[model samples]
Target: MTARTDQAEITALVDRFFLALDTREFTPGWARAYLTDDARMDAPVGAKRGAEAVRTAETALLRFARTQHFASGVVTDAAFGTDDATASWNAYMVHVHHSPAADPLFVVGGRWEATLRRTPEGWRFSAMTVHVVWTRGEPPTAEPG
Candidate 1:
């Protein structure tokens, strides 16, 4: 990588990371597309590291029948250089449950901050944390399997 790499690459990486939640399923190496082998993911439910960390993270939303994650206002501190970079973004997520009962949806507004590093696969997140700023509706009552 050069002193300043292509910022667009980073932006696209951010996009794919969030979009994957919609259709991606849990599988071995599923996280290879976006996370390092030792990546850490901190969510409201909990935190973990290494492969399990990514495994739990990827499956966290499976309890919901459908989920949509939107990432906006992405800001990068070391966007183009440093081998390791920091990027943050605002996310508004809407989740729906399979139940036909009342209040089967929950909406969350949060900020996602991550540490990314260059890997042979590409730009992978070494660490990620979600800070909830606001919420509406009840979240999934069932834990992710």
Candidate 2:
């Protein structure tokens, strides 16, 4: 494939990665479909390896009632000799939780750095790292019984 084509594929793959996070649900199928078998993810929380580990890490977002991930300003730097593609993007994340007293919202600003590779199925994330630059507001809380 041409360079432009490869870039497009990588962009689309990144888009899907964000979309999966926006879903607010971390299903096993989603991981199987989106991430390569040996994918690794690093974030402020910790690091995880493989698809199952990635799923577990992402699912932690479920602590919030609702979640959304906005990925923008994507810039990809690719090495010509290798099939690997690396990209950086600005991320705006919102998390909402409802309590009997009031609803809490958390807004987070961060950057996503990901390395993708072409697989038999398509382009998949081989590694991803998130750097949380800043955060504001409070996360959601469960209702007290």
Best by lDDT: 1
Q: What would the C-alpha RMSD of candidate 2 be, to one decimal place? A: 2.8
lDDT of 1 at 1: 58
Q: Taking the tens digit of each residue's C-alpha lDDT, what string does model 2 give over 1-145?
A: 7677777778787788778777745654667666778988888657889965675666567666667888888888767767788888999988876443243778889999988887788778888898999998875444313
Candidate 1 local distance difference test against the native = 0.81
TM-score of each: 0.89, 0.84
Candidate 1 ranges beyond 4 A from true positions: 1-6, 79-81
Give candidate 2's error at residue 10 in angstroms.
1.4
Q: Give lDDT per model, in order.
A: 0.81, 0.76
> What tens-digit string does per-residue lDDT give for candidate 1 at 1-145?
5434534556788899888787766666777898888889899979999888876766678878899999898877664535788888999999888777677788899999999897776778899999999999887777665
